[model samples]
Target: MVSTAAFLRRAFACAAFALVSAAHADLKVGIDLSSTGPAAVIGITSKNAIQMWPATIAGQKAQYIVLDDGTDPGKAVANIRKLIDEDHVDVIVGPNITPAALAALDPVAASQTPMITLIGSASVVEPQEGKRVWAFKMAQTDGAMADVMTRYMANHGVKTVAFIGFADSYGDSWLNEFKRFAELRHIRLVATERFNRNDASVTGQVLKLIAAKPDAVLVAGAGTPAALPQRTLVERGFKGPIYQTHGIATPEFIRLGGKEVEGTLFPTQPVVVARTLPADHPAKKAALAFVTAYEDKYGPGSVTQFAGDAAGVYPRLEDAVARALKKAQPGTVQFRVALREELEHAHELVVPNGVVNTSAKDHVGLDQRASVMGAIRGGKFVFISE
Candidate 1:
């Protein structure tokens, strides 16, 4: 039989160890983004925003492991596996390119980890079933942006349009969404073309578009590469109005296209034109706050829509983590599940990008309020009323 004093000591030691374990619980977040290669412009800004996140969340120490996927889908899958299997991260964020995000779905679902992707396509989270149930998106969907763009085109008397987008998932989503919205607005798509993101020349595509003689042209590519088609069109003297998608809102697009993209119109989130937004806009204050914070740290004119999307992740995690803590401690499968469930309950939660109101059926909680018609005038993205 053990002595009474020895039993008391053992009980005290066990209690102390449990207390220490609870105090040291950490919330691990794994981030994989294309910090190099074709989508570097989008990924770099997102990385900047992630760097600004606090070291702690919901009273627990936070650990962030960032990996660069180099804009490659296979690399993204490897990164996701490493983060989940090796690091045992509770949540994963990023792989901002659509193909990479799509490729990462299997690993996240298999491990039951939650992912919040920054890509513009909605296919990663839509249909909200199976593997997609574990995925969520930060950027506004292509369909929503297409809706606003088509509405603007209709109001401006653009009856016919030409389409030239990348030969990738991003372009595929844009093409389908634009088709649906354009059809509803009674706008005819006269010419359709596809080009690789790294292609040096799109002269053949531009020549075809010119031959069609559409009233307007829509370039549905993203980042600096998207400038190729528009610049070629301008060089070829296709004078009709040219529209772009939300994907090309970066400063690099302007620098690359120069005079060619001067009057380009596109649908973008309020953060892209925060200063130009009206006072009554729901996202104005949040957008301005993020712009100021981001530009102050990175320098003037450094903020981008991608950075806004990444920064929004902080508030999203904050809201969900606070509630999730009630269910389980961080670093556990239960904690991850609780966080995912709480994310879907976000209601009117304002962030730098826009207000989010998630639900079981809608992982991306933004609506019309998040989108605005923007035009590049005087080398700046300015808001334009439809």
Candidate 2:
């Protein structure tokens, strides 16, 4: 015959075991990336960061399902559909390059799935609500990059600039933002040119840019492909200062461009220069923490801005996941919806790159504090104090 106290204890133990088992149910996270095409360099770093994600989120087991989009928009859309329809991922991240992220917008919006894009396009999450309610961006927008670049130019006495970028939306977005800022600063746009990322040579474009006789040249492309224009410019003896966007911050770009890319200036997040940042900087603590953890696993000097962006998704999802878990169980549509709502309300959250204070009106939620100017020195990125 069991005593009453002993019977009660056994019953409570069984209930606790059941609850723990239920909590262990997988929280699926889907990631789509450009792992094998023009954007591979960017995608690979992002994938590396994703692989390092914590096994648990909001105290529940997590399952991350990754897919390669091949840097194609059609394939990216297909992957997003599969992740939602088949895998039933609670949340989605990635499509690193801008074009793919733009193409994925419709599918993600239609499915009402929240997607965190790694591209540098404000159009990905504009107007805060309505069409883009389900979308968020991890990377800094082109407009933000333009702001800092223009300010640097104004202070550095660059009165005229020539522009060369990819002949796609990425380039178009940069041109639009740069033009907007340049006009306000009274900077003359000497020449504008476009080229395909896979172009064998940019001799013709470089010649035209040189003839413009601008004080500086801005290359508005990303990844390894962005090196082509600068190299051609060097070969053609264009002696003007050459500037690049944050797109070409990876080691591959530096290796490919070699000495030609030396001294190239660009704007980037604080993570790119974590160690050099002041101890009291808002993102310094978080930035160093990520760098330490990532380098400990992947070896020193392997981290990139793209990887930092990928790592950013975890904290962005953390608060949302914790709040959503109270309303609905993971793996359910209701939980995903609740998570989206919570993400929009995330405030005063610090990450490796910046202090994220997301709101319905601002998804990226970063100001000038998020970025610092950097230059390539001896094949490494060095901070350039303003």
Candidate 3:
């Protein structure tokens, strides 16, 4: 119905508009991690997983801006402010440790940016109060880990246990859950102690623990630093069974603890032992898919459970963003708020870590099926069954 010149002119304008829309439509995600501090190993693995995520999410271009928080809570809070105020990121992920993640709650809620934390502290998102409404968690809860550990100890005739962990929130959460479950399992708590994550030694604490002569010991800490207490116990020639929380599932922890960590038991997400999981396991298929993508890049046996936790954010974000786009587009305050609401709507989403089904009442969303008992054997993680 139009002349050649008119049709050509109209087509050019339509193409230009499409290009402009594409340029401004990227989903911006900010990552604050402890890349240079004590939790560097965890941060590095998480960053690696983020780098491997698909360039596009739910048909929209995705852009990620990663910042190092150095594992400091103050730095983590500052990083969240910058991400929200300057970068205008719709969602923020991580600051590997529990303290950093907890410290970030204020800034995240102020900007209405959805935060997905990769820490084991269930309190980070529990109660789902004012600020917590903006936060979600990826790691399995300490309660879930404690339940598995206590059951394992009870079945193994561990009548009494000693507990030593970081003098921070991670340790507090673990101790509380372990105590609750241990009492129910009829296990006696003989001694309780704490140490700083960066303490040069835990000799004094270890001595007190050995004096109690408990049947077993539980170290509630994360990353390579968690190895200090258990390694010190072995050095002290205390030989009852030793257990750790899921936080120490990384290879760096095993390497740092060396032979001292052998036979050490813990509760971890099935992704850590995905290859050994039964074909019918709900998490097996998704976990194996991530393993293939990750190992293909980082080499066989280089994949860590931390990477699985980080990789989980991508699919969850993708699923939520897809639904959110129906109501809002990226790059605006409305988009950020909509993303937060949509994230809470995540239901039955399978990830390498677990099945996610977040809601107003529960943010972590993982159940007992998310945890499987594991032990460090011959410098590798192996699944343990009843």
Candidate 3 lDDT by residue in tens digits, 161-258: 99999999999999999999999999999999998978999999999999999999999888898999998999999999999988887778877889
Order the candidate numbers by TM-score, best to worst: 1, 3, 2
lDDT, model 3: 0.83
Q: Which stretches of candidate 3 lie over 4 Å from their true place?
A: 1-25
User: Clashes in each model (backbone N, CA, C under 3 Å)?
Assistant: 0, 0, 0
TM-score of each candidate structure, all chains considered together: 0.93, 0.92, 0.92
For residues 1-386, write the lDDT of model 2, one tens digit per residue: 11112211222123112111233347888899989888999999888877666566767777778899998888998999998998788888988977788788787777778888998878878867665888898888888889898889999999999999999899999999999999988898999999987788888998999999999999999999999999999888888789999888888898899999998999888778888887677877777777776777677877889988888887788767889888988777788788888888777777778877788888787777787888888788877877
lDDT of each: 0.87, 0.82, 0.83
- Whole-model lDDT, candidate 2? 0.82
Off by over 4 Å in 2: 1-25
Q: Candidates 1 and 3: which is better by TM-score?
A: 1
After TM-score superposition, the amount by which residue 233's alpha carbon in candidate 2 deviates from its true location, in angstroms, is 0.8
Q: All candidates: CA RMSD in angstroms?
A: 9.8, 8.4, 8.3
